[model samples]
Target: MSNDRVGFSQPQPEPDRQALGERLKEAREYMGLKQEDVAKVLGIPRSALSNIEAGVRKVDAIELARLAKLYQRPVAWFTGEDPEATSEVAKEVAHVARAAATLSQQDRQELARFANFLKSRAKAKATPDGR
Candidate 1:
């Protein structure tokens, strides 16, 4: 056999770093958190945070996770895996889910019933005759 390598060796391109930075910046702004405050929480310098937001530096997994927690977002949000990251309703649902996790089974059942009732009310309002 000839001594030749026959395999795809090119590494895949990384995700858009600038877009990631912009999303991080947007999340911070949405939470009304200043960069210095967020940086302090992450135990990094403000300039480091600035560089991260500007896409001049990369954010590692730990830093991203910390930012997610600080911003009340899922880690998937920063990674662009969550399509509903920017949706207010989705955020509310996530918040509710987190709260539900701590509830007793009976409480969860009541919450589900309450949600169904609200859905029925909304559906009734949508009818032409407000049925």
Candidate 2:
């Protein structure tokens, strides 16, 4: 997803796979873990662990959750999918408001639509039962 969709004020593109991989690696390293340690915790091989960090292998949702637990971080921390992503997009909105002196009617309508969509998604994710 683009930064615009997520509320990035700068409105840049989303962080790419390499950036994600680096983030994952950094998180793991910060925990003082070896690749093999993580792999063992996930019951996967060390090579598979390397593959995941390299972004050659796509981690499933379960593995993502497991990784989050293993690293003692929220899943959003792992995916970079957080309120900050939305905040980044929001910053751009304020800039647009200031520069344009007013949001055009059409842009305001579009913003309303997108914001509603964002709200529903947040609701879905925030359900108590882990739906």
Q: Of the candidates shown, which would achieve the greatest TM-score relative to the real structure?
A: 1
Tens digits of per-residue lDDT, candidate 1, 16-127, equal: 7777888899888766579999999999999999878877688999999889888878888877888876689877875787688678889999999999999999999999
Which ten-residue region of model 1 has the weakest summed lDDT? 5-14
Model 2: which residue pairs collide? 7-88, 7-89, 7-90, 8-88, 8-89, 9-88, 9-92
Could you tally the backbone clashes for each prediction? 0, 7
Model 1 Cα RMSD, 1 decimal: 13.6
RMSD vs true structure, all candidates: 13.6, 18.6
Candidate 1 residues lying further than 4 Å off, grouped into runs, are 1-15, 88-131
Model 2, position 52: C-alpha lDDT score? 73
Model 1 global lDDT (CA atoms, 0 to 1): 0.82
| Candidate 2, poorest ten consecutive residues by summed lDDT | 6-15
Q: TM-scores of all models?
A: 0.56, 0.50
Which residues of candidate 2, in runs, are more than 4 Å off? Answer: 1-15, 83-131
